[model samples]
Target: MEISPDAIIILKWNGIHINATIVFTWAVMVILVFISWMATKNLTIGPKISRWQNFLEVIVGYMRQQVREITQQNPDPFIPFLGTLFLFISVSNLLDIIPGYQPPTGSLSTTSALAICVFFAIPIFGIAKKGIRDYFKHYLEPSIFMMPFNIIGDFSRTLALAVRLFGNVMSGTLIVAVLLLITPLFVPIVMQILGLLIGQIQAYIFTVLATVYIASATRIENKPNKIEQKEGSKENE
Candidate 1:
């Protein structure tokens, strides 16, 4: 059985091969774009909103709230990047129910690409919030000797993100495929449903982790003033 959508070639011309991963990834993107257009083309603040619009608003609101809670700051700036990550992954995984449809996220390359985006986004958001100098200064916190370790930590976490997503997605697909071969018909069906749940969960986890990393990068440490410390000490006394 094919372990990755990247191995399934759908087209070939002039020594170039197009795989299922590319096709399905584009398919998911088109579906999202089309649905988004249809839902918002007639957007209104009035009470007569469509169901799709209402559903999308709820999702967006939840995401914004989560970001707010995590960063303790305005969520507007981070929503576009983080929202797209959540939506893309969630939709990709949710569509696994369709027969013969391979989720692009099942591919290591895709997950790695997503992880790399988060990796770079960390510094970008950090630098934007704290300025280039202030952001990089944290890597040397307490001592200049820790700079290499801090840098390594960043790369390690990025690698973890990629492997975590890729392994979960690929394993789920593999389990369903193997069950279909040896198990009864109903068994595979049940596993498919479970796979769907796992997929949604993985998407949520990936998004939450990305949000946390970005939040950490952008967070401002507000140390209490000496006056406040004295006031608290006096209160205790």
Candidate 2:
């Protein structure tokens, strides 16, 4: 199939064209808002919980465990930010399962937007916790000469996150669609299930990497105290 590059709808306002990707992103945001409202409507710690509530709780618990395991520390402080990220990305990716619904994260625009959020968030949170000077000083870690390379590499990781997510989700959607078109038999069903599995795993992987990056940004590294070392050497002498 010869798919046109102009596969997206364009809306013009004041000579500015807003593409389908933006529209899709807005749609996902709306869905996210609704889901959030619904999930928080009736909160309780009772024996009788709705299935929806239970499911959401299970997801939250899993994310908490994963974050703790990855960071080897209490993830309570990071829960709200990382948990929302995991939920949003996972749900966005799974939207493909709905007929006629395309996943927002399948496009580079959406993935890049999320990656950019993480990019900005890492620095903002890092500086907030460690002070602006100290946070920037992190780039010169182990030596000041490595500053340029470290800065470049850090930004490059954000780009990698965006591209990796976009490529993986888009490939899964395209491949499954192609198979379904070619043979409408039992093959498509199998492919769909496999796609679902891949989608969930990819979402987990993306979120985990994001958590790791944020953790690194906020982590405190042990530095040797020159004064203490000198004092110890004088005592030894």
Candidate 3:
């Protein structure tokens, strides 16, 4: 309904710089931490489930399944990071509908920062699992000549992740604002629901893509065994 300020003014030692996006992202992080703690505290494998616990279980299970499918292997290791990403983005996107809250993911700063985290994490996980030399060699990919292309592709994918998320969430925010401005009564409700669906989809897409990237980075390509046997000497040559 109301337009969120592009940035917020923050107190500094010497001066104040207005950066609403950063402040909003900080709020999202705090909320995420609280949610994570609550979920972990009440963890159980029994049939009974609390409301909060059930909600959390649904999200965690979905992300875990997605990651396992993408990697075609167990996803226990990635469950935490990917699950957190999905929950944080989904909740952050919904916050915009609250009276005075704004969705941090709508801001380029927030999405880009998240994408950067994924970028760094991909390499870190790859190196941790496959060793540094092999991890770097993966950038060469299909062939040596494709190294430059593969590197560029990786950078572009990361950039795309940032821009795509920011654009989608911002678009929903702008549309909802415009609808509320035109019809103040009940039209915005529908827009909010639409925003929810869009937000969830975007979150899912982001996490899935991250899982795919991480899987590719960690996958061990089968190498041909170098057994240089004398084919001509097979017949006693």
Best by the lDDT measure: 1
Clashes of each: 0, 0, 3
Candidates sorted by lDDT, best first: 1, 3, 2
* Candidate 1 global TM-score: 0.91
Off by over 4 Å in 1: 222-237
Q: What TM-scores do the predictions have?
A: 0.91, 0.82, 0.82
Query: For residues 1-237, could you state the per-residue lDDT of candidate 3 as single tens digits?
Result: 334335555544466565666677778889888877887897778998788889877867777787787676689988887877887898888786687667878878788988999999899878988999999987665689999987897788788889889888989888878888799778888888899899988987888778777877777773212111211121121
Residues 56-139, model 2: lDDT tens digits: 789888888988876555788778877777777777777777876677777787788888988988887778767898889878
RMSD in Å for all candidates:
7.3, 8.8, 10.2
Local distance difference test, each candidate: 0.87, 0.74, 0.77
Superposition TM-score, candidate 2 onto the true structure: 0.82
On the 0 to 100 scale, the lDDT of residue 171 in model 1 is 91
Error of 1 at 157 (Å): 0.8
Residue pairs clashing, model 2: none
